[model samples]
Target: MKGNSSSLRVSLRLLSAGLVSEEVIKDDTKLVGGSGLSLCDSNDNSKKSETNKALRNHQVLLAAHLEEAAELAAMIQGLSWALKLVVKSIQFFCDDDSIILDYVTDKVAPPNESIVVAKLLKQLALLQTSLTSCQTLPLQRSDDDINSSSLIKLARDAIASQTTWHTNTEEYETCPDCYAHVSPRHKLEVRSGYFHPICFTCIRD
Candidate 1:
């Protein structure tokens, strides 16, 4: 009877181990069937949404920059190119078709002096442009100056003095690779910290 009792106890222990292993296997299978797939899908959707959001934001930024560039171009044409010919009619140099001819102001001036004044005005108006305020300094010279008394002289002096204001020097903004003066008139104007063109050529290396 004691031997039979020992044999029964060993059989019970073996059955218990088998039962525990079966339970553990069921739990692992349920986790794989239920939670694992859902977790993967959730993570994938999160990444997809994140990528979609980034793309939309990039598009919005690009559109805003394009609009800004268009405005700058229009402003340049409006203020800079508008001054190129004085009026809607005078577009080129040989335009001698009855635009207002300004006369000399100095009393008893020599012919050479008068000619020199005209040449000066042409030089001043070279790079003419007004600020964005849609209001520019009056083209007429101030009454404080002796040369301002004559309207013809003032107009001539204005066409010369008003247009010649240029941007900063070449040393303030030079291309690193080529060491050339980059034209500031293009889009992507980098005005940060004394204005320099951050060209793509500089970034290639």
Candidate 2:
């Protein structure tokens, strides 16, 4: 899905692995990057109605090693945003088979060190019952499809923008992958006295 902030126009095209790709239009414009987002502290009431306000607050950060965890975070982020927009039903297309799907759908336990994964799993559990309808399906990770090709370019542009942002900003605590600023809420503890702030999009890439 693609949304333009200036126009409040949203268009859906295709999806995979918790990310939505929209057909680029003449007026396609980028949404504001890095708004506030919080995951674990949200309540059911907040999920149902306060998503915009909540997202305007903090970004959730994960470890560099936790790709599945990041995908889960992106799934939560997309679902919460859709709910905020009052979307009734949702279809998610994932590019590949992922253990994260099993974790969310089957209640499979993550590794003991996967604290972020565990938290995201719990969040997905709450979300599954909250939505009217939601489906997660797989798509072949190939550029043969037009939608897939657009999605790949979108991903590359995002990565480029992130790299540009990092290059122009002053050095501080940042995500190792994207180099975006890492707030306290954006960090996930990976090991003893170690913290890495990896955003979901970067992790997905």
TM-scores for every predicted model: 0.15, 0.47
Each prediction's Cα lDDT score? 0.22, 0.43
* Candidate 1 Cα outliers beyond 4 Å, as residue runs: 1-64, 87-205
Candidate topping lDDT: 2
lDDT of 1 at 182: 41
Q: State the number of backbone clashes in model 1.
A: 1
Backbone clashes for every candidate come to: 1, 8
Per-residue lDDT of model 1, residues 1-205, tens digit only: 0123222222110000000000011112110000000000111211110000001122222332332222222222223323332222111110122111122112222245334333333332333322211221122223212321232232222222211224565222244234543443332333333112444555443
Model 2 error, position 143 (Å): 9.7
Q: Write one digit per residue (lDDT tens) for candidate 2, span 109-135.
A: 788877767777788668756767666
Best by TM-score: 2
